[model samples]
Target chain A: MNLLHYLRALRGIATRELLRFVHQRERFISALVRPLVWLFIFAAGFRSTLGLSPIPPYETYILYEEYITPGLIGMIQLFNGMQSSLSMVYDREMGNMRTLLISPLPRWFLLVAKLLAGTLVSILQAYAFLLVAWVYDVRTPLEGYLDLLPALLLSGLMLGALGLLLSSFIEQLENFAGVMNFVIFPMFFMSTALYPLWKLQESSDLLHTLAEYNPFSQAVELIRFALYGQFNIYACVYTLSSLILFLSAAVIGYNPSKGMMQKKGGKQ
Target chain B: MIQSIAPVLSVQNISLAYGEKLALDNVSFSVHSGECRILLGPNGAGKSSLFSLITRLYDTRQGSIDIAGLNLKRHSSKALGRLGVVFQQPTLDMDLSVERNLFYHADLHGLGRKQAKDRIQEELERQAMFERRHEKVRQLNGGHRRRVEIARALLHKPDLLLLDEPTVGLDMPSRKAIVEYVHQLTADHKIAVLWATHLVDEIFETDQLIVLHKGTIRFQGSVPQLLDTTATSSVASAFQHLTKEVR
Candidate 1:
């Protein structure tokens, strides 16, 4: 209704999310550990096996860890997005979601606020991943850390929206693990998260195009460039548009009159 | 009791279906200030479905719902602003303290900080939950948690309290306490109540009743009128007589 109400609601929702994140120590540790595993073992193993050419974000050849840092950052956001939506599905089953939906605020505003809060939390995880990576010698320009804030937020928003969209379609929390595997593995492997588009092209033309076109790859590129204090207009625009598209679809999927809630309520 | 005043909640001709199966059909009811309207029904009698429509968890397809003179579809914020709901299931985040839950709900209703704190204290104190405010909801028993939820629902001082089977799983004393508390709300304060339940023992002499069965209203009137029509001496027999007719 009033600005004060809207602001307070957003604050409460966001704070709830933070409190949940803090309470789930295993989740926070696992979120960071998943990415750290790749940096310590996966990248360390690939340092000699994988070769790299100079990329837009880099002036000279870089090691595998350096190359995968941005991708790993992307990985953190990607997982955080899905995991937050996973919690949403869990909440719906538990009825906390009903408490939220019944509030006087517009549904769209609530969903957006939810998406934003999830994205912010994911951004925090990404920074944590970045911090660990930086100490591990995956260093970039100091200003890169500051400049990449907007990029991470946008990328996190897009990924979180995608997760929110998937959550709306999922009926049971039990069905979500399979869906996450189906989505996460393909989206991660097909993108430039593990390797560059050129490397994919060297292996196969089709894989090249898929990686090049993948939204996750664009997100990776955006992070990579921004980490070096550089700008890539194409990646920025692509990620932003993907954010809009996914967010709009998520909003639609959550609409009570037309969306998933219209199904019979033998269970709410 | 403010029986002469306009109804705080009015539902007119609300219908709902899931594809081919009708969940609720042509359901209409109203709740005036100081009135407690009980929606009595069997398990599959579409009680949850109707509550969903009222809470806007799902919207009505065939009719309109108005709360405090505001149409729910067009003016949802204003309409919902007048409603407080405690769902069939416990909805408080188990990880968050009781105070946090109430504060979050108050914020959603636009209560200012000092005002929200005051109201939270008042409602919690009323429910005998103020001493346990800082405890996580998980620490409370089923009855205590329900009390906290009731306190949270009242933070905004809504005109209509919509409770969906709030005492379904509680022990006898807890159930009696909740029933007494809610009845006192309508008796002392002018707030209206729409309580959905299958438990015949929970009904009071002053309470109005709606007997719903298989997606339709079987009967709607005061307890005496229900007794006259069903020719039953007690609430239990009357409920069984009304519900078992079509079966």
Candidate 2:
């Protein structure tokens, strides 16, 4: 339980994750391609056709590409979190996770270390994506860059925790593709990923309410507010509360006594 | 063995199940410091399941497990600290050098860089892997990779070591070398060993043997005691005779 001890463990976990990113050169590049494809290809096609009312935060006419920059960053965090969790499940199947599980550390500490490690990687990807956006003229406040770190870290942790929770219950790794279709796509698209929640309200009242209450929407708004150099109390509260809830669920899901992972004797 | 040796680990009537499917039923065994106990069983005989329960990789619904007089459930991290386990599969990273692989493990155990460096050197030397420490595991032979795993397990100086099918893919000589090395550790360092495997050849005459079948302990005793009445002389032949008779 020593602080130095767990910090060392956290470093190991983070280093291991970074190594995976290094070895799989193609995977590292492909992770960026998915979000860019959504930005460059899909967003470009929809920019002229989509009608936009004035966004509250927008002082002037903002390009759709600039408006969606925060959402794309959120997209990168969300997918990267799921991919990290998928890798964990893959490790469980491949026996690497057993190495972590069998370590002589408290399970809760191990869980937190893993979450922080994954979140660190997710934030790295998000920053890299933001750099690409900057070149493309997707402008935000100069100080916005400094303010976005905590928002990105919290959103990454919350999404990673949710992914970890799902991993504990996922029957098999093959089911992960199904989860992308069911859990991830809906969470991203049904939220304010491409447009504001208020903008969705013009289309359908039911969709607006769903978007307003969505945890994913809260994450997007938190990051969006931070990206614009503004503080939104409700978004910050919602993001932090969801982070706590998801992290608690993830910890409980990995509990050796009751978690679905406890069934160790079944076929690997 | 010490003149007055105490048991390093004790398991009493531990039974485990998955819903209604029983995985281990009333399993009990013990090993004193400096002793080696071999678990001989066929597939689905609960050898791996027993390892899982002992390591607390999974919890048990029934019975108690104590390591160095501490209950496993009450002081899991403390109890687990005394245990070093080599799984049935290769768990080391293929891309990382042997040293880096062990370094990652040392960090997980919370050892400082200097301390971990010293321990890693000592352990790799103990397993005769120091020469190959800088080589990526993928470049090494299967036998050498397993040696790296053994070295990794020993980094923390665990009191009890559990190896589940540790020599699954190694050649005969490599397997024998590992077996002899572990035997030497038990004698020289007074470390307890739980070596689980289906191959009865892994069980030496001096070692205690447990025969697990269908999630139950079919037999447990010294190799001599188990084979004394049989006409066969080797542990493998004795196992064949006993299991055949039971069947």
Candidate 3:
């Protein structure tokens, strides 16, 4: 595609995603509520029962409420990314996907533009959560804001790529709900969202090792380190690698000539 | 099939299946420039599958489709660019303003801001939606939304247009208006039109008609040829007879 045409295509797909989010008020609010529910209610209930342990990035045991902020932020991006792809499946059923797939630009570019738009939305939601955290007096270094931007972007892209990968393979929209049961919850709970690796290591070594290797855990770690104005090389590497890997897999999964989606969705 | 100077669209022995269920069986037909081909079929008759193949929505298991001389598998996006499609479902964004929806489609076609604005204005006027341009799609009636879709489809000046059961649910007047307008466009613009519908009255005597049944083309000829004999006086009756005979 020519440069001018490419820009317009990107603009079109991006704007469509944004407009969809804006139009669906209940959906946007629900996305925010899921993270907030964990932060205010669930986190509060577990705050007292949880024994304080010195988490790595922390010099001393900190409040459970404060410790989980980064995890909540990661959770928001993860769920929103999946939601974006789920909507793509919905769009396909509704016939809107046909409009997009028929556009005279490379389908990969269009899909990437969609992922970028989802990341934008996730980042915006994360910022809103940050504002609430600040009000709760969960303080971080001033430099943390600057450091966290790139980390948040990387995490967003990583999660967005995963969502695209899922969208490419799932045959029907009904199967997406099953993904939440089988994939989403497991990934979120097995990661370092609620507790650090050291804490999990004491409870179960195998589980701790699994969490440490989970790419999502690395994403959460990257965000956690950046939130405290620290650099995390391991997290950075893992997140980048996952981003490339998921995107490549999604591209292969969506190859129109030989993709399974044609076999599944080609019928009337 | 009769030869033409240059066929705008062609399908060659295309067969599509959904696992054990076949959706299209060796369906082949060609429509030349300026002709209107109405694919008449009942529900589950594989008309929609043919539309999907022509638009390259899914790869055919057996056969090929070409649009404006470009093979679908080789040049899908380019082929789609030359074809405008309005599916049975309304694809416009309901929350955005009508004009905004048109602008988004213009961008999809890679039109510049100035050119898109000009073309949007022209298309809206053509569909008499210029006055309601600022209204949100959620507020518009069903017929108006369909008009917006048709207007959006025309933005790229396509070589061929496909309307898959475009007026599936609409008041009689609204359906008549769309039918008349599409017929006018086919003649005026000389763009080959493939209008898929089940209604017999929608098929004109001059328009080429094809009867699709169980994923295959049962009969393809003018309305009169298909309605030649046996109590099958109307196109719908003829279609029912052909499909029943196949069973």
Candidate 4:
């Protein structure tokens, strides 16, 4: 395909995703509501009990809600990422994916278009949640907003790629709930989304080690630092590498010859 | 001397398997422009598998496939670009309007906005759905939805059109309508058609037919030739006789 055609395909696919998101108003509401509830109810409940030593970016101690704001943004994107994969599973079952796969574009290009589209949606959700947080008095510096853009995009891509990788392995929509329980919940809970790495270390060495290696933790840390206009190189490298690994796995899984979807005994 | 036109679709020695169970064994066929080739088979006869191979939904381990002279393996984009497909399942985005669905397909094919709009208008009008173009696909009946899908497939102006059981679940009139429309597409547009179905009534005596059974081609020839070989008066009886003999 020519450049114009590639651009058109990207625009069409992305616009379709946006249109689907718009029609499903409840999805937007619930995506925003889930984190806000955590920001308000969970954070408020834990605020008094939790104590923090001044972390590097902060000169003084921070409120629990303020500390967890970036994590909540990551949470919003993580859920949206999985939700997009759920739609992909539905698309496969409904045969819409076949139509997409039949497009003249290279399969990888098509997948990248889909991943980018999902990431765009997640970014929109992240910004909306940030706006709500700002209104609720969990304010970040003005420059931090600009810095958060790239972090939000990278984090979104990482989580979205993970979702794509999972979707490629998941054959049926009926089994997605199990994945949500086993994968989503574990990835969210085991990561530093809810607590700092130091807190996990204080609790258990094993848990701390797990959190330290978690890609989701890397993503949350990336966003957390970016929200304060700070760059975390370790988190950046970790998240970028994870994005490439998961995305390559997803692309392979969707390959008709060698991927997970390939029929055994079929020509490789 | 007249020069022969190349076949729009050519599948040679294509084989597929699902682990130990063979789905297709050394299947081969070709369809030329303006020809309607019916891949007639009963359920589990590897009709879908063959369609999948031709459409590149699955790869061929043993053979090669070419679309409008473009090698599928070596020039996938060009090969795929020359063909349009309608799968056995309904593929329309139910939430999108009929027009939007066609528009999306046109965009996927790289058609510009103006050209896509014009082609969408023409196809919808041709399908007698122009009046309802703005309606969501979910609002349309099965036949209309199938028609919309056909329109979407044709927006790219493919030289070959692959339809896998395009009339599976429709009423008799709807089924008849789709069959006739596709036949008309072959004749009027000179589009090669590979239509896979198990229904005996869908086959016409003049059309090319390939009888597939249990992952192999039981017969490949004109419908009349099939009857001649099976010593049966009708295509249905011939189909039964051939498949039974193979078993």
TM-score of 2: 0.96
In order, what DockQ does each candidate have? 0.81, 0.74, 0.64, 0.69
Judging by TM-score, tell me the better candidate of 2 and 4.
4
Q: Report, for every candidate in turn, its global Cα lDDT versus the true structure.
A: 0.90, 0.84, 0.85, 0.89
Please write out the lDDT profile of model 2 over residues B159-197, one tens digit for every residue.
999999999989999999999999999999999999999
Give me the runs in candidate 1 sitting further than 4 Å from their true place.
A264-266, B1-4, B245-247
Docking class of 1: high
The DockQ-derived docking category for candidate 4 is: medium
Considering the two chains of model 3, state its CAPRI-style docking category.
medium
Name the weakest run of 10 consecutive residues (lDDT summed) in model 2 chain B.
Answer: B1-10
Could you say which candidate leads in DockQ? Answer: 1
Q: How far off is residue A251 in model 3, in Å?
A: 2.6
Residues A44-102 of candidate 4 have per-residue lDDT tens digits of 99999999778856678999998899889999989989998999988987789888888
Runs of candidate 2 with Cα error greater than 4 angstroms are: A263-265, B1-4, B229-232, B245-247
Model 2: what is its DockQ? 0.74
lDDT of 2 by residue, A1-268 (tens): 5889888998998898787677878766877787888778888898997766667556677777877878888888888889888988888888888899888798878888888888888888888888887787777988998899999988898888888888887867998998899889889889998988777888999999988888888888888888878877898899899889888887787887877767545555
Error of 2 at A246 (Å): 1.5
Clashing pairs in 3: B25-B215
Write the candidate numbers in order of decreasing TM-score.
Answer: 1, 4, 2, 3
